[model samples]
Target: MTRTLEWNVHLDLSEENGTTKAEAVLDTGSEKLMGHGVARCNPQDVDIPTIGDELAASRAMKDVAGQLMRAADREMEAVGAGPTKGPLGKPYAWTDVAG
Candidate 1:
């Protein structure tokens, strides 16, 4: 059977003291996942707000992706499907992981 679901993501950003911070939120209907990241401007480097925003936002998105993977791993474990194991663990099926 084919299933379809929609999830929404929102981001919040702030800058203070030469540092840019970003927060990513993923709403999965049943729960909310949060990811945070920060970027600091070096004293010798140019102070570009847009660059900092991009860096922080990228990091925050990466964080959210990692959290989503971990949640999926937990769900697989609950369903008697073990998580994948290797240099970088993942939750996808057909991995080396043995259920």
Candidate 2:
């Protein structure tokens, strides 16, 4: 079986008082997930607006990725796939077990 699905991700960024904040929203039609990040510019470092924006946006994307993974794990467990800790201590499917 083959299937195609499209998920939409929207990112919003803002800066104020040397601090940049970012929010990532993932829309899966059936559900919406949100992630947030913030970046601050130090007085010693050069004040670059783009750099702060990039850093905050990157962090927000990472947050969203983590949220997506957690959602997937929960769905997997609901289907009785069984959840286990992977080598890196991440949630994973456990298919080998005795009933």
lDDT of 2 by residue, 1-99 (tens): 999999999999999999999999999999898999999999899999999999999999999999898887798889987466565554335653532
Model 2 segments beyond 4 Å from truth? 85-99
- Taking the tens digit of each residue's C-alpha lDDT, what string does model 1 give over 64-95? 99999888879888898855465754435775
lDDT of 1: 0.90
**For every candidate, C-alpha RMSD to the true structure in Å:** 4.8, 6.1
Q: Which parts of model 1 are misplaced by more than 4 Å? A: 84-99
Candidate 2 clashing pairs?
none
lDDT for 14 (candidate 1): 99
Q: Assess each prediction's global lDDT (C-alpha) against the native.
A: 0.90, 0.89
lDDT of 1 at 69: 87
TM of each candidate vs. truth: 0.79, 0.79
Candidate 2 worst ten-residue window by lDDT:
90-99
